[model samples]
Target chain A: MIKIEHLSYHYSNGEQGINDISIEINSSTSLAIIGPNGSGKSTFIKCLMGILKPQRGSIILNNQNINKLSITQRSQHIGFVFQDPKEQLFKSTIEQEIRFALRKRKDQKDIESQVETILECCSLTSHRSKHPYDVSITQQKFILIGCALGMNQDIIIMDEPTSGMDYKGIKQLAKIVEFLKKEKKTIIMVSHDLDFISEHFENVMIINHHQCIYQGTFKDACRDETVLSQGEYKLPDIARLSLMAKHQLCTTHQEWIELWKKR
Target chain B: MAQLELSNFSFRYQGSQDYVLKDINLTLKSGQFTLINGLDGAGKTTLGYALKGIIPHVFEGTLLGEQRLNHKVFQEYTHQELTKIIGYCFQNPWTQLSMIKSTLEEELSFSCENVGYALEETRFRVKAIVRLLDLSHLIHKNPIHLSLGQLQTIALGTILVLDPDVLILDEPTSQLDPLTRRRLFNHLSDLKKQGKTIILIEHNIDDFLELVDHLVLLEKGSILDQGSVIDVYTRSLSIGRDIQYPSLTALLSTITSLDKPILNDNDALTILKGVKSHD
Candidate 1:
């Protein structure tokens, strides 16, 4: 479990990026963080990653204060996939990229096999030898995520993983995230892709104006018009359609159809 | 005359065996808002680059085709001349940034300055674009410090400052939140009204369905389908192409045997209400 207490961060320009934010995230669950641009979602993630030390408060993971931990130690517990895959992908080939992190862990004796497993999990076994730049943007993103998974972190935080992806790519990523969840890996996603969020994440935290405005289940977050509006988000299409149909908010098209059939 | 035209267009990067774009033919009238939908690696970005005169010039590719803008051969124009007529916003916002610019205003003004616009004129364009894009609050902030969505807005604003007749945006709203995406589309609508021919490459077609005059679907570097928005969208849906349709369209199609295209939320609601009333 991760507990954040009264966290605050100020930007270099003296702007308050996040203020008095507190939240507790239980292990082995998926959480979606939704907000408008520059609403401190990234800042909060940075604090959690130890990239940016919070000006005030503490972040405790598994009863240990993460603020006091070294960067390498912190990374052992948390893996972050940045919004832009280009920032994290530096290796020549996809296989090398995934192996780069695993080789660093002293306990990862079978790094080659670990890389092979991750490549299979990410559906990139065929493209393992291809240069990272040669693959599509979606594949590049998956490669980075694969690298994070290879690190064997307890929690993985993905920032806008679905942005710029086509429908097929989004579907593939949805499956990968589901696979990760089945493996009991805790996942935190910061995204504006409401469709993906509603379909995958059970819990949600809505950030607005440098603070956590709402935190609840995904269904409640969709139905909460005030929070949605404040966070500058629209309910996923199926959810909105279900709401208009005077039915309970549905996350997926199938669920919406199921509700329609029942009606 | 078509505002922009391409015929028998095909291109392959130097030494590349496979063509990135193949046998593409398209025409756009003045002020038409066209949305190009394609799967990943389907050559949407390459098409945008070609339309912006970056294909044979900057990228150095084997090209086979003819392109014309406003009845003039596009290749005959130099890069500077093309910039005056076409503005291309790349898919990656960071790639379009002028790294030297300190603030959003300066970033927007950098292009105009590069083209040797008068200082006063550059300032005027910057202010107008800022107002149009609702970026007043970020005017003085360093663009590097801004979020991805904010930087995207700045990148687009930089291009808009040039006032080119043709705007080619490759996934401009990919990084934006829903509200900001809507606002960006509204601005695009305004630009469309002002007679700018806009070509957009997008996956999220929900907000753009109504705004788009035409839809072009690309599959594996080839034009799979192109027509009026309704025609292309409905056909794409019927054929089970991996394209995403607006949710309302999908819902209406599923719930009712309605053959007509429902473009927006209100239209879908009305159709749903009509169905309920009959029941």
Candidate 2:
């Protein structure tokens, strides 16, 4: 659904331009891009969204060079959720924001029904009247997702959606992602929450030193010691516990409980 | 003596009808690690500001009780005096940083210059704090251009250079990644061991459960519960309210069926592993 080739772009400050990056994202699948603070992950996503035009490279969406299309035209094919919630939300209420996005391309007769369906799928009906900025960061994220879904864009890119959320909040987001999966909306998320990505996302991409170093299944990529060390990432808690058991630090928790019972 | 104390305190922001904090009573001794846990909009930040004398002073609110820092009544102390005794890092670190600086070193000097510290002493303090936080590499980076994690470290470095008796942070790890969050907590843990009184307003219980000596829960601007870490979790769980313990604690709570629930991450891990062993 999304493709980038030999992409090279630099900031106005003259920092390195993505360093000839090339990658492809399949349709109806999720890809998580992970990296350290300044590894150009955000730059890569922006180029894909056509927010920044790569100086020397081609970005193709559905077999057409995105460089040839206008920003709004590219947005019809790609939807982006920024890292900062405040940047994405300017509407008075949650319903109004989703409605505004729907009104752009949706027919006037079908707008209300489409808005309702997306809001329901995103679990934002209860907060329809509430201002987008007034809601919690977690809820603001869902509101963004609802607006993106309203556009019914082919590919949705989310940046750091789980940075400040608690367990309950993270679970709430995961449930929405699950629904998107069923709806076959291709997803690309930039997350530092390794555990969240490993559990939910099928495909993982590790961007290190301004290059795509690893891309594969979440389980395989996370367990790779090289990627973990280079990206400063850690395995999920369950995987870490399983690794500890291999070292004979301790057996399963159930085994220890049984021994205590006998004692 | 407690570094901070609040007794029967209540506060409601001006122009608001209801109190954001109600009937709060607690004491935090110097050199102890304390965690303040609460749900969204539960007045955790309100209580943090109240402890730092920001409630009635910076934020116009009705105050209905006594608060003291280092045995000095909060109302009796000047804002400068409060700054010396208590260092409060607001939830948003960006707002707290006020200097037009390009580097972390310059940011530290901005604080020192404002306080009129001698040049030699300011340099020494800045170097010491930078080394303490392992921020030697970032000493020259632009504060605005830094990442969220780096900005948090710089914010903390600026505060620690002042050497306040009590350090209160509101959601310090809310914007950091897992790796950065771990590093930040390690720095806090080291500060606690060095006899710095630390108060953290946070929701990431899994990271700090084992380090916190006391746990306080707030709801709708009222003190819902406060006690030792284990006591608060146990009491809340017995009443059927979900305590904000780590995942391991929740799992063990189900297996043991005990009224006295544990909230510490290390304790919960031990218990969960034991259960797994038995089964």
lDDT of residue A107 for candidate 2: 68
Estimate the overall C-alpha local distance difference test score of candidate 2.
Answer: 0.76
Report the lDDT tens digits of candidate 1 across residue range A29-144: 89999888888999999899988889899999989888888767798889999998888888899898887878776655577678778898787999999999888888888898
DockQ values for all predictions? 0.56, 0.31
- Measured against the true structure, the TM-scores of the candidates, in listed sequence, are 0.94, 0.87
DockQ of 1: 0.56
In terms of lDDT, model 1 sits at 0.85
Worst 10 residues of 1 chain B by lDDT: B270-279
Angstrom error of the Cα, residue B120, model 2: value is 3.1
Error of 2 at A145 (Å): 2.8
Q: Taking the candidates one at a time, how many backbone clashes does each contain?
A: 0, 18
Per-residue CA lDDT of model 2 for A1-263, tens digit only, reads 66778888887766664778877888999888887765778888888877888888898778878787877888888888887778778889999999888877646769978878878876788889988876777678778877887877878899888765655667778887887899898999998776667667888888777787777777676456676667778665544544443322112344324434542
